[model samples]
Target: MKQHLKRTAEYRISNRRMSKSGIASLSHFLYIRQNSLFDIRCWTFDVRRSLISFSILPG
Candidate 1:
């Protein structure tokens, strides 16, 4: 019974530590994802605007 209790306590401590790190990494991943998506949106918008300008100039 004592060994079982000790093992459970150790497991709980490790789980808590892992959860904190997991949350940090998950948030970091989301931040990077959001920035990349924003960059892609701006790039596409710029490309479309330049294409429109070029087409207008030719006509």
Candidate 2:
């Protein structure tokens, strides 16, 4: 990955507490930069999974 991509990934990782939609947006932005190297839609899939899992688990 390029320096900018690495930086963006770092930023996205740092926003772990952000909303799923926000996370997807950031991931999509990074995906576009990667020239389709990363599948952001798939990333959002994982995010949705996490959301569902979180909703199922006890608080």
Candidate 3:
């Protein structure tokens, strides 16, 4: 009856909240992962450039 309806509403609200938080956390994780990958790419590029310069200087 009324109590059952109330319980159902509460359950739905909680489920919606959980899904929102889950999406937020997932996007946060992806953002961090993307930044880390970009950093790694930059680091690798810098290292390769330095190596080329060093080799040219020796020659």
TM-score of 2: 0.35
Per-prediction backbone clash count: 0, 0, 0
> Which residue pairs collide in model 1, if any?
none
Best by TM-score: 3
What ranking emerges by TM-score with the best candidate at the front?
Answer: 3, 1, 2
Q: In model 1, which range of ten residues has the least summed lDDT?
A: 49-58
Task: Write the candidate numbers in order of decreasing lDDT.
Answer: 3, 1, 2
Alpha-carbon lDDT, every model: 1.00, 0.83, 1.00
Q: Can you write out model 3's per-residue Cα lDDT over 2-44, one digit (the tens) per residue?
A: 9999999999999999999999999999999999999999999
lDDT at 24 for candidate 2? 89
lDDT per residue (tens digit) for residues 1-59 in model 2: 59999999988877764777798899999878896645777788899999999999976
Residue 23 displacement (Å), model 3? 0.9
Tens digit per residue, CA lDDT, model 1, 7-47: 99999999999999999999999999999999999999999
